[model samples]
Target: MAVLCLMLLLLAGDLAAFMQPPVFHPNPPTEYRTPNCAQFRLPGCPRDLNPICGSDMATYANECTLCLKIWEDGHDIKIIRNEPC
Candidate 1:
């Protein structure tokens, strides 16, 4: 009876551990900024709606807009993903 109780306790412990929610570690927060459009000569981007995500965590209207910002601001901005941020 004691051995059976010990086995049941062990099983219960395992079950409890399994039932616990998973823990996830997310990436560290990044510093983002809004580009100063007025301070620089803005390039005339096309009206096409090709969305893109930039390293600045902003959703540019398209890749041309992001490139224009990078060129005007002299910042090393890169494309984070192909989707809108």
Candidate 2:
């Protein structure tokens, strides 16, 4: 009987620990540096509607459009996210 009680107590402790919520640690934000775009001279992009967010906090029509802008203005533009800003 004593051994059974001790086992139950240990099982209760294990259950308590398992019932607790898990802790989450998010990763730190990434730092992005602009690259030189002067050497890349790309052609015109297609007229698509797939929007994407840029590191410059602007919403681009698509990845091709973003590349076109980088080639045209010679600015270091990067895609921050796939969705619109």
User: Using lDDT as the measure, which candidate wins?
Assistant: 1
Error of 2 at 76 (Å): 1.0
Q: Which ten residues in a row have the lowest lDDT in candidate 2?
A: 32-41
Give all candidate RMSDs, comma-separated: 9.8, 11.2
Model 2: per-residue lDDT, tens digit, 1-85? 9999999999999999999998743632265434333434458566879897777788888777778877778777877667777
Clashes of each: 0, 0
lDDT of 1 by residue, 1-85 (tens): 9999999999999999999998743543364434444453457767789787788778988777887978778987777666676
lDDT of 2: 0.73
lDDT of each: 0.74, 0.73
Query: Scored by Cα lDDT, where does model 1 land?
Result: 0.74
> Which pairs of residues have clashing backbones in candidate 2?
none
